[model samples]
Target: MCVSCAWGKPAKPHPLEFCENGAKATSWEVTNRRADRAFFAAHTLTELETWPDHDLEEQGRLTHPMRWDAETDKYVPVNWQDAFEEIGRELRAMPPEKVDFYTSGRASLETAYMYQLFARIFGSNHLPDSSNMCHESTSVALPESIGASIGTAILSDFQNCDCIFYLAQNVGTSSPRMLHDLQDAVSRGVKIVTFNPLHEPGLQHFVNPQMPGQMLTGKDTPISSEYYQVKNGGDIAALFGVCKALIEADDALKASGTSKVAGTDAIPDDPSDAGTVAFAAAMAAADKKHVLDHDFIRQHTAGFEEFAAAARKYDWAELERVSGLTRAQMQQAASTYANSNAVLMVYGMGLTQHVMGVQNVHMVVNLALLRGNIGKPGANICAVRGHSNVQGQRTVGITEKPGLVPLDKLATLYQFQPPEWIGHTTVETCKAILQGEARAFVSLGGNFLRAIPETVAMENAWRNLRLTVQIATKLNRSHVIHGEIAYVLPCLGRIEIDEQATGPQAVSVESSVAHFHGSRGRAKPASPELLSEPAIIAGMARATLTKGVVPWDRWVDDYSTIRDAIEQTYPETFKDFNKRMFHPGGIPRPLPARERKWVTRNGKANFITPDRLFPEFSLGAQSDDVLHLATLRSNDQFNTTIYGFSDRYRGVEGTRRVVFVNTADIARLGFSNGEAVDLVTAIDPETERRVSGFTIMAYDLPEGCCCAYYPEANPLFPLDHHDTKAKTPSYKLLPVRLVRSGVAPAH
Candidate 1:
């Protein structure tokens, strides 16, 4: 419901509050097709493996619990008791450290909480999740910059913000509902500036579906005030350019004696505020009077001296060159930001899916800090999330790495000794499995095979596992690639009724804004055999642990018991969980940055300046034909879930195998608009990681930059290519070159 879910909490929700994609997602889940025992009996493993991703899932909900029969090469129905028993036996046989537990954003808060608790109690910390593949950089960077990993602003901030810098974020395609907010902002005179390698149509113009006047008139709302097609892997440089512009503007104002604190003589002789006076004096004495929030920085932040010094080193020419934009364009964007009273910056995977993803976010924080935009009304950083409850999943402990609260706290709360060792992330897990260092893998939900980069490598590695289990609502590519003895356990969809032992139950999910709301299914169960994720988890825990303090039966039947335990475990944040969860709107978790409170190591927000400002853009001593490739999602898709083959918004019809290339690049490479080419990895000559027969279409993109849909182009990326700090794969930035299918080389 976009209307009810909008920033301002309306007293009454609008009758029509959902979006087109929302309807599609619901229909996709509530499909009539059923994957019953007959379905499995009719299809063999080899036959099903060749089906398209959507086609396999369209076969419908998995009706019965099944186990892989290696000899017969088909999945046979198994009772829930036998499935749980065998899984538990295998889990207990292996060293807990050798097994990894994975989760998806689709799981509810209760499921994620119980799943993590089960993993820790079973003596393994290897809890990798879908967050590691997307938005992990947001989690890693924001915590180091601010006190928390989550964004600082609520959705209401959009109403009052004067200007918004949309960096590498396409609100129209990824999250279409967000377009309403952008439209409202535009209508209210809010200036929106966009920076990306492609000029996204959603950011350019959008027609509101709920508004009839414009729909009939065929007029659309203009979204972006200015759009800059920044080169791929140039976000750091573009952000640096903005910071540099502001610094130089302040320097110019100081030289002209037009700044508020231009000289020491202008300062009042208020002895009580000597620090402010001294700051002015120091600025007057320095080569450039740094026009920063001196009082706020001195009182609430650390490392400004180092950050400012590093920022001053980059001049306009260097930044412009690196960012692939002219000096005037950067200056205009900076001027808009500097002139605005309050500015909100929203960014997406375009800025994050890079080798330097962490640094890119740090630069965004640096830009926000330059004008003191954080911790104020209508001013903050908004890292747009991909899925519902991704943030909640992390909050409830679905992390491969945990440092906020110690294991002792969890141990004391749950009355068990939790594992102390760090777990493997999605990238590390792939490597560990490939090297035979890890044996078992259990996934709560997610299409692991398609969601991860280096698809071939991940699939090849996962095939060597002793056991692999998937708890899902629909069949995905992960179900096809399995271990020697694999298991497919069907689970209830989010939109299906869940009749627990206590009563009809409801699960909660957290939105991108950090508000937790109850989501109860309205539709009937797709199949009678489907089990709730929490119930399945409880069954597994009971079968595995000979004895434990936690009551699994009670927790599964009555979800309120799970909430009570959650409240006790996260007392400070989840205080009175049951009372607040049932409120008109669910409770919001504590955000330290919102109140200008820094809970970081030094009790202050840190202005981190990396040793280097830019990441390596070269293909590492490879052929010169390499171009930067950015993997994108179709308009009709959400993450790895494809609703239809047509991307109506992009005018891409009936195909997802097209490569978008800049017109200049196409001509320079002696290729036409509709030429067929083979996309190959430029980094490793030894490996033939090629996607053949991809049609190249001319697009509005920067030179040396191309675009294609992900999972299809994932083969071009090496498994190890990821952010050093975040361990998120560099899906958006890959070194690639196109080889003509039938013609000779142009160079």
Candidate 2:
């Protein structure tokens, strides 16, 4: 495994252990072009729909199992047992709740527990993945705050956290080995902060090519000791202005008192009451024990007096007019988080692609539960998990909105019949194939109609389905946007070499801090006609599961027989799962809020509140010619894999269409330095949604916000918007307007 930078592991191994987009994601999976079957018999679904998704994934890898012949509209080749017997005869002719499935955090946790155990034994708990498009609001707001949606610090608690925060994340173009753990948490003095409305440069200043006097003085280091910008759905009004300035500095250091005093027989409260005796002698010479941990919020949390009466119902001039940030930058970020005793925070997908992303993760867990900051040493909250095994494919049961995987202990350890309703997400599988009630989609690796959000109404509700498939290894553009029968297949990539038939196996992933381990594969395969995402989900669960209690051909030939049925179905989080994944730096699973133990439903640690602390969706309420937008992701791309059209850390270069905005909102929206444009959205007087040329560019954002890039603005989003309790897809805000339309390039 070359890159496990999804939090902690390299205690020692370093021979270019990965980064620079993990060596451009392993040189875009050992590239040397392949697509074969005569490159889909000389490309044609109207010339691979005019290419460009990095030229149809650099026209490489795919190799076989094709299908979509729709009167030879093209994707020819077929085999792999007649594409799993015509996707199991068009998914047993519909109604496994009409087939949805769709994973892709680049598979392999034994192929996402054998693709959610062949979509709940070929029945259907729709099982969506890519964590329902980025941490489904920290998996439904950190299990109602601190119970567990992962991340209670641990990467050696960002090296003793003294204060971190970095909200609405960017970590220098999404996880550049978390800038060597923010350069050892800012060389041990910590403090960071950030917030984000743009101005990102790896949260400003990094360099560290593993230091060596910063490559002989190229210097760098800094990383955000404060930033702020905010405002694109202003993270629950900049985290309720740092929890109303840390509850007004813990009620002004408990109403002013001791100025000097050794055995204080009083006398301090009156130098003519000098500003409440210099705010209680600067909170008694800072010995008030760093403001508020109050014995970890009186022994492991709960709704502190209704989240401190909704944090004294927000004031500081409506938290500086909805977090544009002022009141002395939220009192110097509440005096660097009440003089830090350990903070952490961290966020991303700009606090989960908003519509009040689970009330901006319940106001970032009501300012880390007002100082208890979840569990012990170096406080918590992390979130920054973008893609790499996307939280290990929702820790092995993939999911489609259910609560922490139990399914009656996976139907009594994989016997079957579980599906008790709740499924289809990824915008309810495009509103169940545009309300014709879904019709077979499958996926097992992503690009779900180009990382979702309206992309032409999810490719016209997946072209009114009736079977899609994908399984993927390269060729994207959702394999030439098909349906009414499509296929694709391919597979084996985590650096190739798979083999099967019970011998050289390996697989098992987990990482982004739930740990687990083992990944194995050492190059070679790009094609030996692919196959090995758990043997194409055990050859489509032994040809559409007759459910012979899952041996799926001896767990795709020895993946430790699928880690012994994932320790008999998540036995208290994979206990002894193949001998704790051969130890040496592996087994983390347990969590119980990292041992404070609130596993939710009111066991403890909650404080959620926020029905509205501010930012109840605001882009021009109806239309000041809209704007908001957001979208982003481009340091030469990763999700939706573009790899290069240059972002070169936001100075951009060459191009990826453009936008960025706010040099006084481009001189009050008239626009100039590089114009062109278009965008749109509308959704009324007979619908809209545009997206033309783009350009714009100004910079250093945050004025009714802007930005672009996604699956190129995922077609101005509207697929029934999103986030009513984390259904996700608000794709970082999106309202739109733009217009102009021509003239920019040149010099």
Candidate 3:
């Protein structure tokens, strides 16, 4: 029986809630597992490193504070004061710019806010967060395209939508709660079109494990109205194809001298001709409507005209060729959307994890604006985030490159001159480490070593650090890979209540739709030894800083004071932050686009021309035999962490080492299903890096495209293979080749 079953009746009393993954999170936290000093004493760091990620975590959660002993090569137990003093000494001794402070979504708003405050007070803006890896493209592209980085729609909007166009995002595994919304929408006659490379179970049928009747009968709810297995990196082309088809249809109508279709009375009599004219008109309107603060853009942004010009040139054939989507299919998508009362375009890492990811987001926004889908009810762009509070972290100053406004606000709030120098992004931080420019790294949360791309290089860079501090809940690959002086500080998990010196603290979290709500943990702490992240950060700040720049103790003692600080700092949106959080659903920040008020200088949204018609990938002069490989997550996994070996949705069982390849490509490459091959990537002419050996599986994937699990295939990705604007790794694009060994090719 599962842990939930053991409790007779589950404690969760909320209606319209709970999925398998949610249950897993709850159970994992409530489990009778503990990893303390004795466990570390029993096992050496080398021995622990040899264990599988799951086994090590399953051993029990880390329950005590640990400090790395260089000679012993193991994390030994240390008191809280000792750990803080040591870390404080190292951090205070180093130059502020030489230290990199990183944050993960797992950190609470109180913790995240304190972390940023500490870093700013220390006079360094070196805060590189997990957002850089995931949705930086959304952050980079959406604001320029629609005058906002977040979606204009709320969860309730899905209920009234006529159509939902889901691109690249897997609803079931990524955000299971979205499945409930999708199901409800489908039941209400909403058309859902899913475009992905693999046929995900969430897009097919999802059986609510929590529904007793459904669980007992093994019944499943139908999901997608239409599923399109689009080729990888083909979303932009697919979008353009849809737009072109709409344009062509409009052109044909105009040529025939038909104002409207005989059967369709919905279209206006003077409906403008489609094709280039309609696209151009839409682009023009958006540009006139959306403009960034011109001063900020001129001062902060580079390459504006180049991007605008690229948007002006749109060719259907070229788009079709690039996207691998049929013009007819595109037309269908566009027509369906245009005819629909309301449409929502939802996406995830699939669209953003590419070389042209930023451009891809721009295209998606262009489509939304063409039909005036944004800022209205039941219509918007939904970037289904991977983690719960990832979006919130960014909103509260977790960025490395915080604009002048945020920095200035901090200075006024604390009476200290914050650093004006631009901080390092994730990729830059790695480069800094490799170049020995950065001396120390402090991670609020997250398995940095495993989550980052080019794991081998990242590990080496991590080792070069003088001091590394990880505030985490459990033991992961990151804890094992240590700097010269390392500390593993166990922090309170989300499931555990964070009672500070004052009272039970509630931290704010930003949901996917940009709604901010307070998340108060209901469960007891895993251990009394575990300290809240905010408390730990405050303790470090108190011990490290020579001068008290801000009232760190007040904020740490009571989280409400932190809210007060955030409200004062970002008064524009976070007004009455403390009072509003008490609302049942919480309040949403004022998105200027929601009211069609673009924050741009012209007070209008702008159309940015793409730099290139199509993204180009050259993995060291690709050989004829080489194939481009894309790294992806299995259904059973979330980001870099794997829950199990089986990928139930993809039909892979008991394995994480298998690679999916198109049958035609496998045949052409003289390979067969189950054939083991060495996957080599051309990082450079002199260095041919081997990613990993995998047994090939002939899957119904697009020809010229292949995919394998991430981190495992991360070795194939060079450090430099990333989006130019977002600095996100091109995990969806890689140039590689297969080499057969020992056995003959399948007959």
Candidate 4:
């Protein structure tokens, strides 16, 4: 997290220009062009559905509470009291299982805490959130592997690392702020190796604007020392290949008289040669030292024998076929890891958005474990979060599974018995709504309709809801796709001033690095009608839970009370919340794995063994015709918010409907560059899912892999295509065929 995600005082705030389209939206939101009660009344659901997502949002900030009028086929203004009372009545009319409480990642810690608390008090555990879509695999696998849900390394590890394994992260488009960290690390002689389907410019080099010299000279610093385009969903195989190579090299070295390979067959086997300048120079000339941290592995880890045997059993041919990379490339990566003092394996959605998402993370941890990299200063798994405060939301107990959190402490402190059973995930929520089991859908913030898969199917099922509530700052696709009786309550954005009963209040956000810092909005609210997220939640809680024991109003008045309660609930992690929150850099939660202390059932980091070497998609799609689609995001996009039609990084200038494929695949599939193609998935003959009119652009990707932008390509994803362990939607792994769109390409 950067300045926007923390408590900081800059002459000018970071959100103004650095946070993608945040600054531009902030400027337009304060203008008179916004959606009021009248705007809603004038528009019908059919009309709103026709509006582009950008235009729907450009209708500006939602200035009043609105409810859908079935008779008029429009949303009419409703006062906060009536809206809250109506929502409460509807909720009370049905069992807690009928409602789904969903939250976006951008909400503050206080708001998330109260939101989850309200759901539990209302006797519902169905709290599906954005994390369920993105990094839920990390949440599921990390604890099993290392006994922690967070990455082992913090921010400082980047600077101290000797090498970094960059996997599937397109830094330029997604998070440019991280480019500075990568730039700093690379400039210090740290070797960065990247593995991705697309050759992202951020992974290649970066021209830091913050550094005046580089900007003045228009020079870019080279980043990755080597790059490998591993096939989609083949990251586990790629990593396994490297691990096998490392193990074999070490075995051969110790088995023979070779102490250090040093790139020569006649090298000496002296033990004292490790530190000598001549020997060190000779070692530096080679790719690897052919050594392993056996002591660290034996003392602090478990299941090594089983894991290694599984990895070694897979021959080079199978690994090469699955990974779509040469054996030499994997060996080179292993050599870099072997020679490095500390290696950081950084991965993004490329690894997590798969059928084997949890196993993908497990393999990354296993790779680090092979060399005893975890719990060290500059080495470990770095599961980069897509959003800023997503981890924080989960940290404050926003989860469907009650066992994943400290619910016992919460029940003890709040004096309310929460549901113990696991609730619906995102996919389950969609299914429940389709089957008429889910009566209502409540979202704190985010464009849930546009972000989810099977847009058409969900749009049809959305109307089945008895009620839908959107607590948001602006209009979105979700707002327009209204339930039978819908309410849109405007809330203050992060940049807006949140004036509370006491005074202007601040809310703390926990960054991905586990650092907790307060965020106080300084800009004026887009409208005077706007309410803070805490205030809106408090209103919902007050109206719903009349006999509630918790003091919602008091907490809303001063958020420090919420923080105080949070500290009491999570005494170990959030101890002295208020005091440490506004402190200089913020307090960090103590992760057990950070100190080589695994909090697993066996009290040691376990090497997870997969029953198979490759993912189901890779195994099933053996031929080049059944191409695997890895959905991507445009450079001009932030989640579902499309800022512009241009994606300068990917070389697309004026359109979002385009697909990139390798020349070999384009030819093999009987398609050519600039050909309009319809990418369709045939799960069954009766059902056809197609994203039509996509122009084919030839790019460097694996033969069986093609790239298309997300949300647009979301329809091709099967609803059931998800990680079994985490239930995370496998956005990356999709088998689709290409057919001529029979439409002319836009010139």
Write one digit per residue (lDDT tens) for candidate 1, span 1-747: 121112222223345655766677788888898888888888888888899998988887888899988877888999999999999999999999899999877788899999998898898889999888888888889989987787887777888799999998777777777787788899999999899888888999988878888889989999999998888888887887776566655554454464645221222223233333333344456543355555667678787667766665766577776678886787678767866878998888887888888888888888888778888888988888777777788888888775644567678776888877888898888888888888899999889889887778778888899999999888888998899889999998888889989898888777677777776788899888988999999989888875447778898889988888877788887888877775664677788898888778898888888666556654555445677899998878878888779977677898899999989999887789988998887775557678878999888888888999987898888887899989899988887889887543333
- Each model's TM-score, in the order given? 0.93, 0.37, 0.89, 0.93
lDDT (Cα, tens digit) per residue for candidate 4, span 10-64: 2232342254433444454455577887788688977988888878877777888
lDDT agreement with native, every candidate: 0.80, 0.74, 0.73, 0.80
353-427, model 2: which lDDT tens digit per residue? 777787787778778877777677778777777666778778777887555677777777767776777887788
List per-candidate RMSD values in Å.
5.1, 21.6, 6.4, 4.7
Better of 2 and 4 by TM-score: 4
Deviating ranges (above 4 Å) for candidate 3: 1-16, 210-219, 259-317, 619-624, 741-747
Full candidate order by TM-score, most accurate first: 1, 4, 3, 2
Winner on TM-score between 1 and 2 is: 1
Clash totals in order: 2, 1, 14, 0
User: Which order, best to worst by lDDT?
Assistant: 4, 1, 2, 3
Model 4 residue runs over 4 Å out of place are: 1-32, 259-290, 617-624, 682-686, 742-747
Give lDDT: candidate 2, residue 151: 72
